[model samples]
Target: MNASPVTIPARRGKAAFVAAGQSIKVINTHGEQVVDTWAFNRADITEFMSMEHTRSGSRHIIPRVGDAMLTNHRRPILTLTEDTSGGIHDTLCAACDRYRYEGLGCTEPHDNCTDNLAAGLAELGLTPPETPSPLNLFMNIPWTPDGEIAFEPPISTPGCYVVLRAEMDLVIAFSACPQDLLPINGRAGKPTEAHFVIA
Candidate 1:
């Protein structure tokens, strides 16, 4: 892993490799950007992080520090080690894709997390077996007792971050989600760059 912080540019994505026991610190540089995150087994992309499986394993919609993020195969991939970003994250939403923007009335091609994931992995001479539901870092999705959920701006302040320890040798990806149509990024609807450091 690079010692310097790696940028996940606004409206784009980045990916990296982490060995077991290593940790990655994801920074919300500007505070409001929703980073769509994913992780895969370094030896087998098919065995990737699974939000549904993690939810079943942890029994929590929002993971807290010390919770292990599970893979589709029901094994640990990454574990939440430390968090300073208000403990607000969404594991329920799928990564934004072209069809989502299209439904939101975009007539032109839009930068999206799905594409960004592929692009990021492509940079490492790899491709995603499929787009899995991402761990939406810094995203705020409030739910009601009636089972309704609403997209809201993040509550995290600038420079707040979360650290996830790799449970296995894995590849991690992140997209500084380009969702300007909604306030998921912020009320300003401006998606900004984010950063991560592997240590």
Candidate 2:
């Protein structure tokens, strides 16, 4: 309810392609929420991201502050930029639909999560999900010593933001985690904010 002053009616699940030098700021209007992010060279989406590239170069499955988030090509797509709470954000958790949620305990049918992701791509004029895995921004999944990851509480506070300056002409897509069963999005459900400022 206390989103930043910017008015973006199409905020949820929307893909926005900020130009080569633009900067976008994501705000967690509510504290301890998770958001997912992915970037692609505007020239070609197929030449997109790969898990091997991002995880190998930085925070592994859990991204930390000031780390470089690399693309599959070993190029820096985005720097960690800023992290407030230092809570772990997952690079391993995939977006969940009703199918995936059923196991997580959502017995009824719903498609909002996938719809939110699709909203951005649709607005960007790109096709459906092509990347094998998505890069989650504020979501937390605690890493175990045995090499397993667990979804954990959010590390961000209200108004905490991560800033990304476009390294290339990038089509950045993000989802305010619509995880009804997950803690990061706030099980109560509220709107998240995305603000684009020209770099």
Candidate 3:
């Protein structure tokens, strides 16, 4: 366990304060939770993780061990060091927002990952103009041979986790996705806890 671990409850957001050389482990406490994660250079928020840049640099949509998470400046910010869940993880999907759910017949205001991320980072006294699309850990969005994209139930079981090592000091923010319309969270629409440890 980390000296100061944090847990983001289902349908909420939180931040993990970490430094360069430190590692962060994201654990699906109750399983089937898709955590949307992103990070910013602690010194400069302008230099933040860019999924587009990572894909361009790594040349793979589904990252593997040793893949560098690149920033908008095309610099490595973190590296995927370990993964206990061999299921699908997504890099191209954008975090859900209020408008997304409204389109899905959600009449009431919905808690969303984008807002959660902003709130989490605000707790650190840092705010970026916009939240970048995050690395969707444990998500199971697959592209089919017919060039169609499908949002399927997560393949991750309980206790699944992934470890990422920071390449630079970062203010990492993650949200236990509050998407109630998808099977990404095991068809429960109920978010689960994610154990975040920085060591």
Q: Please name the candidate that would achieve the greatest TM-score relative to the true structure.
A: 1
Point to the candidate with the largest lDDT: 1
Q: What does candidate 1 score on TM?
A: 0.99
Candidate order, TM-score descending: 1, 3, 2
* Per-residue lDDT of model 2, residues 88-167, tens digit only: 56677676655777787776865444666677788767875464467676777776799876666676677777766666
Show model 2 residue runs off by greater than 4 Å.
1-11, 129-131, 187-198
What TM-score would every model get versus the actual structure?
Answer: 0.99, 0.80, 0.96
Question: Candidate 1: lDDT of 133?
Answer: 100
Clashes of each: 0, 3, 0
| Model 3 Cα lDDT, one tens digit per residue, 112-145 | 9999998888888877658798999999998989
RMSD of each: 0.6, 3.9, 1.3
Clashes of 2: 3
Model 3 TM: 0.96
lDDT agreement of model 1 with the native: 0.96
Residue range 7-71, candidate 1, lDDT tens digits: 99999999988999899999999999899999999999999999999999999999999899999
